[model samples]
Target chain A: AQTVTQSQPEMSVQEAETVTLSCTYDTSESDYYLFWYKQPPSRQMILVIRQEAYKQQNATENRFSVNFQKAAKSFSLKISDSQLGDAAMYFCAYRNSRTFGNKLVFGAGTILRVKS
Target chain B: NAGVTQTPKFRVLKTGQSMTLLCAQDMNHEYMYWYRQDPGMGLRLIHYSVGEGTTAKGEVPDGYNVSRLKKQNFLLGLESAAPSQTSVYFCASEGTGQETQYFGPGTRLLVL
Candidate 1:
């Protein structure tokens, strides 16, 4: 079984500043995928970013990027120039590549607060 | 397009009551899933269907039953509700397998 861990239960960042949310996972499989999802007060889960284990280069999506260290089983998300809208509960997820399973193993989640 | 939608945004059931939660998707996705989100426990899969007329148990399926009669609809039923089964239930659908899943707003259920 794969497990994702988000050590920080709460995090705060000043507006226009950068903040990194830590995420780590445990999986015996060599090939897999890592994802970060954000849930606002609306409780709608939205995919923020994803990283493929085979890719050595980190994935970047506009202001959202990940520091993926496969060897260390770490995949952290970095939000550059954070905004008020970025405030939400962030969850890290894990998936197996071959199974194509939609069943994502998620972390407990971290509440991100954006200060103006 | 509605993407994914779960009927009865909120529901309340008695300990021995039986009810069904409907999930409909318009994305033409072949795979659909049901998950329960509990506080501090993340989300756990209850059941999933790969295609129409096919359903399978997921991580947590002991108390729930699911049906995928049409390609666009998936239904989850609790034969007898319990307090422990109360939680926010979410429905998700993806393409063949490894694609990013699009989720529904979720249904908040309370059992007393």
Candidate 2:
């Protein structure tokens, strides 16, 4: 079974600054996908970004980017020019590519606080 | 279009009570999933369906049941609710080969 871990339960970043949220996973399969999802106080889950294990280049979306290290089994999310809207609970997820199973395994989550 | 919608955005159930939570998607997606979110637990899959009339158990299916009679709708049921079942439930759907799974607003369930 694959499991994702977000060691930091809470993270704080000043507005307009950059912050990195750590995420690590345990999976024996070489082919897999990693994702970061954000949940605001509204409790709405939003997909921030995703990275494919086979892709060496990290994935970027607007101000959100990922640092995917396959060999180290680490996938972290970096938010640049952080805004107050970035405050939320961030979750890391994993999915296997071999079975093409749509099921996702998620981490406990990290609460991100953006200070003005 | 309403990507995914869940019925009774908020629900309260007493132990031994039975209720069904509805999830409808207008994207005509072939895959639908049910998950519950709790404090200290990000989200856990409860059930999923590949297509109409096909339902499968997920990680935490012990206390839940699901049905997919129509391609656009998936129903999750709780036969005998418990306090442990109190949590927010989310419904998600994705295309056959699509990587992104669209999520619903979510239903908050409180069982006493």
Highest TM-score scorer: 2
Candidate 1 ranges with C-alpha deviation above 4 Å: none
Instruction: Work out the TM-score per prediction.
Output: 0.97, 0.98
**Model 1: per-residue lDDT, tens digit, B13-98?**
99989999999999899999999999987889999998999999999999899999999999999999999999999999998754
| lDDT string, candidate 2, A4-92, tens digits | 99999999999999999999999999988899999999998999998989999999999999999999999999999999999999999
lDDT of 1 by residue, A1-116 (tens): 89999999999999999999999999999988899999999989999998889999999999999999998999999999999999999999998887755589999999999999
Q: Which 10 consecutive residues of model 1 chain A have the lowest summed lDDT?
A: A94-103
Return the TM-scores of chain A for each candidate in numbered order: 0.97, 0.97
**Clashing residue pairs in candidate 1 (N, C-alpha, C atoms within 3 angstroms):** none
lDDT of 1: 0.93
For candidate 1, give the lDDT of residue B18.
95
Candidate 1 interface RMSD value: 1.1
